[model samples]
Target: MVVNTGKTFDPQRMLGTMRLADVDRGTDASGNHLIRIAGKPVRWALGCNFDVWPWACPATASSDAVRFGGDIAQLTDPTDTSIGMYVGTNAYYNGIFFEEQPDGSHALTTDIAAPHYYADGSTVITGSIRFRVSYDLMRTDMGIPNPETLTSTSLAGAVKTPTGAPAAGKFVTWHDPDGGGFFIEASGFTFSRKRLLVDAARITPTRPALARTVRKTARRGVLVHTRALPRGARVTSYAAYCRSASGHVVRASGAPGSSVVVVTGLRRGRSYRLQGGRELQGRPRCVERAAHPARPSLTLRPRAVPAARPAPASRGRPRGWRSTPHGRCATPTPCGWRTRSRDSRMVLNDSSA
Candidate 1:
């Protein structure tokens, strides 16, 4: 299947492959024509999708498969069409291409295979080249009308949520280029694949971001807290890195696209830098960002002051001592009952005398 798209399938070894030309087979003694397929050429069926790359001619609906998406095939003879191994349609002279539409959209959407008959005006046999066709909705949106050079770095399926918070219980679902769906149950997730897509879906019920927030003290009783988050920009896994005691750069990964995740047990006087992106359910990854300055004061708070209480009544004054106008006890002097006044003067009671 991959070979039809001009790609090598390395995961599995090819036992072998063979090819055929128009003259390879001729009318036999019975006047019946013969054709051959080398090795087990992957068969193309109607309406079934096969994952393929951009710019490569794609296998499509066979001429005989009437029960399918649509009957779109191109037919050309020696003059109007040339035949060869090629990608995009070129006037049907050599390679694959349907007649151009008024909108400049040209395509070769039907596979040219054997075990099929040529219709008088409908189907005709072409050269043997298993190729691929471009999908209208997904590819052109990827900007492959004329076939662009492709790479995992160049694909664009990651999209920003509508410039605001996702509605309650709503989340973005990640899909691969092949139309398979995946998502992080509680955190952001990333996967490695080009031509991938991430879109938002709001169902009847919403789900929560399963994030893990941590608050731990790596320094003297001071907890440098970090909150593991579920929602943010980007759709890949995230990481935080800090210098460890062994002078090594230690890292901690949080939920994919986690908005807030705490990396704790960090030493004092050490700064941490964050990198990586939110993750989905796949292996591919990209970048995103979340940042904050060093704030290490969560364990201490101010204490309240207590009000002053009234003093207990002084016990019976010593013998003749009595209370004076000032806040002091007065002693009887030889001249008379005397006390130091608030004005810092000694006053004598001559009337008592």
Candidate 2:
């Protein structure tokens, strides 16, 4: 008789009280049949734990065989255990997978090629990306206005005046024929009128007259030549005035011709004019004698009186005697001289006579 083994496996209850060590034995509940062992249980489980939904599935497989699901596939290396599958949103796809190894740790399955849908992660969260952005701002309404255009016709014509002078501070603008505009400092008068008015009002300087003509004459009198009229012709008059060097006019009427005009009484080196213009110009020459005709010749002789002389010695004194207690002269006197008391007079004796 053949027994039918058609029991459905429940993943949650199948390995209920079984330790990992017991799972090493490939035993069904009946324990009557032995299952094939492809490799070590731990290594097998670790290898099959990798993500591989596209690879393998078995029909009528028990829960123990497919409990990990058709999504897992066997890793060629027993070192892989854990599994990873892509569940990305939008356009992203898995670039790498993680797997658990026999050591109970996870690692990337570097052998598998990445999916075609996989892409490099975006640096920004926004879906759209641009390399750069540029913006420019320009002022449209604000700018400097053009300078006001000026014309020659805008200026006033030249000002005109009828009678009085133009009022102070009155102003008028005049245009240059060349199109330059300017304001006049004055107003109410024509250009020529203003010039003529100024000329009439301005002060005029007067020309100086000739100085009085001076003439000299000689009249009869005792003319004394002096510094007052030192080198000029001598003159006299009934009513005459002497001019001092200080510009003083001293009058002397009815003075004698012999009267000496002392130039010393006047200042030195000054000019004066004599009276009687041309009327006394040709009078007879006056004759006068010098007051001291011998004065000039006397100056040539040496002065008779000695300028100074030493006092004589006392009576009965020897020719060279001195009255000093040592009987010697304190200082020598010149020849023909002597020394005496302070109050004694000096006498010049003509010994040869």
Candidate 3:
């Protein structure tokens, strides 16, 4: 077997660089065994050939197996099945003893141990078996983590956060059960819910004219008071912003549903505007105007009243002229009725209301 107690050798360059040994036997055999040298583990491979010729008649073809163990004592007196790996070949034989039987031959190209494992190159073969041993060097850290040493925190702090917030889905964080700390995400847990804030199409914005008088405060700030909002609409939040030499700078934000918003840290000479965020529970009902008729306009006709009995000529009253209880004179005109009040004594000859 190849043993390197010094620097590691490159695998690509180490190809065809093995030290090989061949052993031929007919009985059971063991290839080789090794112990760790310095700090590096041993690396090895084995190839074998099994043959049963026609001349060895009447003898049944048996199997051969190979295995690795920690020590020679353990290999000699194996207690558990974990100590060995079985290798074998198959053959066909007639039930009758003298009948023809098929010959058996088995071959192994190269059997390499799993990564991160030491190849002890130990084996036992039976019945006319021949094998070769090839040895090389491998890096100690060339494989995945050992299963026996894995724990819950093995992948701790391995997750990375995205640069921007995702439009959908969730961000998951892992917690360390032993340390009671957050890992793989943010430092603390933040809980939030999606809110259907406001429907602009169904809601009206706050009007500046309806604002209350701004009251200045002692702390170089102003308390902006607002009047009652429109029906079904209320202020959700407020902010105060002022135009600076560069751009509009927001000074502060106020609590929800507050009529008086306190905006601080204002410059004395700069004008600041206070704005309120509004949401509508529901829109106000609108009164629609009456619909006009499709056809022509209507015309009203006065009913014909029977002509007042003509005043008697002998009484010296004019024709169709009569007096009522109020002492008002009524006469019939071609258009409609005509009346004369005593105060004016004026003639009502036109059909007017």
- lDDT of model 2, residue 190: 14
**Candidate 2 structure quality by residue, lDDT tens digits, 1-353:** 11222333211101111111111112366653332212112100111112563322222111221111111122344322221111111111123233343422222211111121112222211110000000000000101011012122321222222243332223322222332111122222211111111100101111111122211111112223221121111223233334534565533333224323221122222234333111111112222221223322100111122322423754565543334534433455322223331334332211111
lDDT, residue 277, model 1: 26
* Per-model lDDT: 0.27, 0.22, 0.26
Ordered by TM-score, highest first, the candidates read 1, 3, 2
Reference-based TM-score, model 3: 0.18
Is 2 or 3 the stronger prediction by lDDT?
A: 3
Model 2: how far is 11 from its true place, Å? 99
Give the Å shift of residue 98 in candidate 2: 99
Query: Could you give candidate 1's per-residue lDDT for residues 159-261 as a string of tens digits?
Result: 1222322312212223223321111111121111111122211110112232322322222111122333222212345445444335645455555434454
Runs in model 2 with CA error above 4 Å?
Answer: 1-237, 244-246, 253-264, 276-353
Q: Tell me model 1's lDDT, rounded to 2 decimals.
A: 0.27
Q: Which run of 10 residues does model 3 get worst, by summed lDDT? A: 135-144
Instruction: Please report, as a residue range, the 10-residue window in candidate 1 with the lowest summed lDDT.
Output: 185-194
The true-structure Cα RMSD of candidate 1 reads: 23.3
List the candidate 1 regions with Cα displacement exceeding 4 Å. 1-90, 93-236, 244-248, 268-353
Instruction: Give the number of the best model, judged by lDDT.
Output: 1
